[model samples]
Structures are given as structure tokens and as C-alpha cells.
Target: MSTVFVVGSLNIDQNIRVRSLPRAGETVRGSDATFSPGGKGGNQAVAAARAGATVKFTGAVGDDAHGRRILEVLSEASIDAGHVRVSGTAATGTAVIAVDDHGENQIIVSPGANSGITAADVDAGLAAVQAGDVLVLQLEIPTALVRQAARTAKGRGAFVILNAAPAPRQIDGLLDDVDLLVVNEQEIQVLAGLAGMPGNHRDLVQALPPALGPAIVCTAGAEGSFTVLDGSLVHVPAATVAARDTTGAGDTFVGYLAASLAGSHRDLPAAMIHATRASAIAVTRTGAMESIPWAHEIPASAPKPATPDPATPNTASPNTALSSPVVPN
Candidate 1:
């Protein structure tokens, strides 16, 4: 089994359920507030573990109660938290989230300890990654650390999966070191500027610089996901379900995708279907990490066709194809 190393952020999410999202300058009463373990990195780590991967989470948190609780949550999920550091100078990162009846959410983040991650910290985390392992990264922490981690993982021959969320001002060759670039329409737009528009899976893949990596996956909420796999355009439709909270859906998708790719050693298209189904399950519930489903909980509706043959080792050459796009099942 391939191990997953998550180098990112750890945050305590303060969430509240409201009848509807608040309007501009409108203060609306919400249900009792609750706190849960969250953050892009932490959520993806938990999601990957639940999806049946050996996950190691590396990030920083305060020595406070919130930090302790977050660590406890990761431990419960069977994620290795030994690499996570305790920062004395800053508090754990936090996210204030408001979820409406429609399952839509708005989030405001306060990057505290997450911003304190140093190059040394990233170096320590990268030590766990070996060739053929999967390294999951996000932008919740500092960009410099993200680059450092990317370089380290790439150097180690580990598969580098970058979830460029909360889109930075410049992707600026950040994708150069990444093996797989996962993002939504908005994020791709930010990373690629005008080229990233249209946001179609094929278009985004075509627009992205070849140096940014060989494969790209663009997710469009309920509309499903698009990707260029083996020179073909594959679209995986989202599973239908009642949504109670959409938070962490993207993280769920990314986590499951990484696990499927690492565990199954299948091509990008094969992994995407599994991820889309897992994400469909996530939005049906509330909370970030709480909403992510375990491997057994994934529905039968999510197609997992035998491709590249199950008997084959999960190892496949990366970015060896970019032919004309053929529509896949």
C-alpha cells in the first residue's frame, strides 16, 4: 500500500447552521455554534485515511486546547500526527464558517500557526516521503513552504498532488514541480489568468503550461469533474444526494482521488470517478472532516471499472500521454 504524506495546515473550524446565508450588512441569528477539526491539509489527510490510506499529517498548531483537540481528531482517523509541531508563538489556525439550509457555506480564515511553518518544518515532513509515495499539499500554509515541499517530494520521486485552493495571486510556475494539479474553475482562473477561463476540463488542461505538469483535474461541484487522461477527455458525473453542508467537498474529492490513484495505481480517469463519488457523500452531511466518508461508506453508484487491469501493479509512468482527446466512459 502506498503511504500518503500531507503537508499543509491545521485549523479549528467554528461552524454555525443558519436558515440562509447572511446578506451584506445583515446580522442574522444562527443555530448554536460548534467547533470541529478542519483546515485544507487536515481535512484532506482525514479524508485520505477514511478512504483507506496510510496518511501522515505534517503542519503546525498551537499548544492550546484547540490544537490538542485537532490532534486527537487526526489520531482518531488513524492519521499519523507525529510530524505536526507545536508552535509557542502562535495559536492554532481557525476558520469561521456559516452554512445555510441549502448546504452552501461561507468561510473566513485566520491563519495563525499555519503561517508559522518554516522550511525546516517542511524538510522534516518530507523526510517521510519515499519514491512512489503520494505527497498531498495545499496553500493553507506559506507558499514558500509549499514550494519547498514540492521540490522535496519531486526530488524523492514521490507523486506530488497539489490542491491549489484559496487561489494565490500567482501560480507562477508553482505547477512546474507538481505531478497532478487539482482545482476548481475559480482557482484555475486565478492560476492561469485569462487562459484559465471557460474552465472546461479539456480547455483548462489545454491552457495550462506543459511545464505545470502532465495531468490536470478540474471539478465543477454537482456538475461533476473533467480531466484529460491518456490523451482523452473524461467526465465523471457527481452522485446525487441531499446536501446538508458543502464544506470540505473539494478536500474530500482530492483526498479520495489521491488514495485511489496511490492505492489502485490507476490512471487519472480511474481515480477521478472514485473521488467524485466520495465527494458526493461528503456534501450530504455537515462539518468538514466529519462529513468525509470512510472507504466502506462509499456508494455502489460510484463506478470503479477495471481499467489497466486490477492484477497490474499500481505503478504507471507519469505524463507519458497527451494525444487528441477521446471521450471516455
Candidate 2:
């Protein structure tokens, strides 16, 4: 098994369920509220660990109770936290999430200590990475730091997988350095600038630049996933399940995808099938990290993989559709 290193943010998620989201200047009563450990980095780290990956986490947290609790949560998930740092000047990062009746979510984040993750932090943590290891990253932390980590990881002969979530505008240069880029429908549109792209497997694959990386995976919630590998495109449909909350589905998908890729199964299509199955299980529950399924808890048989569309055309354009709206938590 290959080790997975995640360099990102750690946040305490404060979640509230309500009948519907309130309009500006309008007030609505929420049904209930709960707090859980969450952050793109932390969530993916936990998800990867639960899916049987040897995972290490590197990020910053505040010297507060939330920070301590976050560490405890990561420890419980068996994620190595030797690279985590605590800062006295800042409070722990927090995300205020509002979920409506339709399993939709809205989120507002306070960066706090997560923004403090520096270049030096990534450099010091590079000692744990080795050849064949997988280094996963997101846009939650500073872009400069992510770039530095990618460069370092690549130099060490490790595969770099970047989940460009919370999409950043300055990600074009970083794509060339990444080994894999996992994104969603909105992200693809933003990167390709193509509108009404049919959300098809081939269309999504043809959208990305081939020289940027060896593979590109585009996740479409409920509709399933699309992947482009070795100049070929494959579409994997999502498993059907009663969704209670869609808060961490994407994170679950990416995390499990990373784990599967690191494991004995190097087949990208098969790994994505497992990832989609894991994410389907995630949407049936509530909360972010709490919803990610453990390896033992996954279904005995995964979903049947979908064949790529042979007749699909290559419609690559610069005028892209609006990015997919994130599910409110």
C-alpha cells in the first residue's frame, strides 16, 4: 500500500438543519444544530484513512479546545498527525453550515488557523513522503503553499493528486505539476470555459488539456462520474441511495479514490467505481467527516461500472457554464 500525505486545513464544522435557507435580511428558525470535525483537508484525510490508506496529515489549528478535539478525531481515524501544528495567536478554523430539507447545504467558513499553514510547514512534512506515495491537496490552504508542496512531492517521485475544491482562480499553473486532478461539473466548466457541456463522460474528459496530467476525473453528483485516462474517457454512474445529507459526498469520493489508487488496484476505472460506491454511502448520512464510510462498513458488492460512450464528440470550448453550486450542509 502507498502512503497518502494530505496537506491542508482543519476546521470544526458547526452544522444547523433548517426547513429552508433564508433570504438576505430574512430570518428562519433552524431545526437543530451539531458540531463535527471538518475541513476539506481533514475530511479527505479521514475518508482516505477509513478506506484503508496509510494517511498522514499536515495542517495548522488553534491552541483551543476545538483544535484539541480535531486532533482527537484524527487520531481516532488512525491518521498520522505528527506534522500538525498549533498556533497560539489564532482560533481554530470553523465552518458554519446550513442544511435544508432537500439535503442541500450552504456553508460559510472562517479560515482562522488554517490560513496559517505556511511553506515551511509543507517542507518539514516532506520527509514522510517517499517514492510511489500519494500526496493529496486542496485549495483550502494558501495557493502558494499548495504549489510548493506539489513541487516538493513531485521531486520526490511521489504522485500528486489535487482536489481543486472551493475552486481558486489561479490554478492553471498548478495543473501541470499535478499527477491527477479530481474536480466536479462546475470545476470542469470553470477550467474549460464550456457551457451546457451535456455533463457527459466524454465531453468532460475532452475538456481538459491532455498535457496537464495523465488523468482527469470529473464528479457529477447523483449523475455519477467521468474520467479521461490515456486519451480514453470512462463514465462511472453513482450508486442509488436515499440521500439524507450531501455534505461530504465529494470529499468521500476523492478520499476513497486516492486510497483505491494507492492500494494494489492501479486500475483507474475500477478504483473510481469503488470511490463512487463509497460516496453513495456517504450521502445517506448526516455530517461531513462523520458520514464517510469505513472499509469494513462498505457494501459487499460495488456498483456496476458504466461503459464509456463511443459516439460522443469532442466539444472543448473556453466559454464554460456556471460552476455547480455546492450542497449546503
In model 2, the Cα lDDT at residue 131 comes to 80
Q: Write the per-residue lDDT of candidate 2 for residues 1-329, one digit (tens) a residue.
A: 88889999899999999889888899999976789989999999999999999999999999999999999989999999999989999999999999888887888999999988877889988787778788899988888888899989888878788898887675556765687778887777666543333444446566554434435788988778876543445678889888888898899988998888778766667778888889988988999999999999888887766565566543433211111111000
Give me the runs in candidate 2 sitting further than 4 Å from their true place: 23-25, 194-202, 211-214, 313-329
Q: What is the C-alpha RMSD of each candidate to the true structure, in Å?
A: 5.7, 6.0
Question: Which ten residues in a row are the worst by lDDT in model 1?
Answer: 320-329
lDDT of 2: 0.81
Candidate 1 lDDT score relative to the true structure: 0.81
Question: Which parts of model 1 are misplaced by more than 4 Å?
Answer: 194-202, 209-211, 303-329
On a 0 to 1 TM-score scale, where does candidate 1 land against the true structure? 0.89
lDDT of 1 by residue, 84-138 (tens): 9999999999999999999989999998999888898888877878877888999
Candidate 2 TM-score, true structure as reference: 0.90
Summing lDDT over every window of 10 consecutive residues in candidate 2, give the lowest-scoring window: 320-329
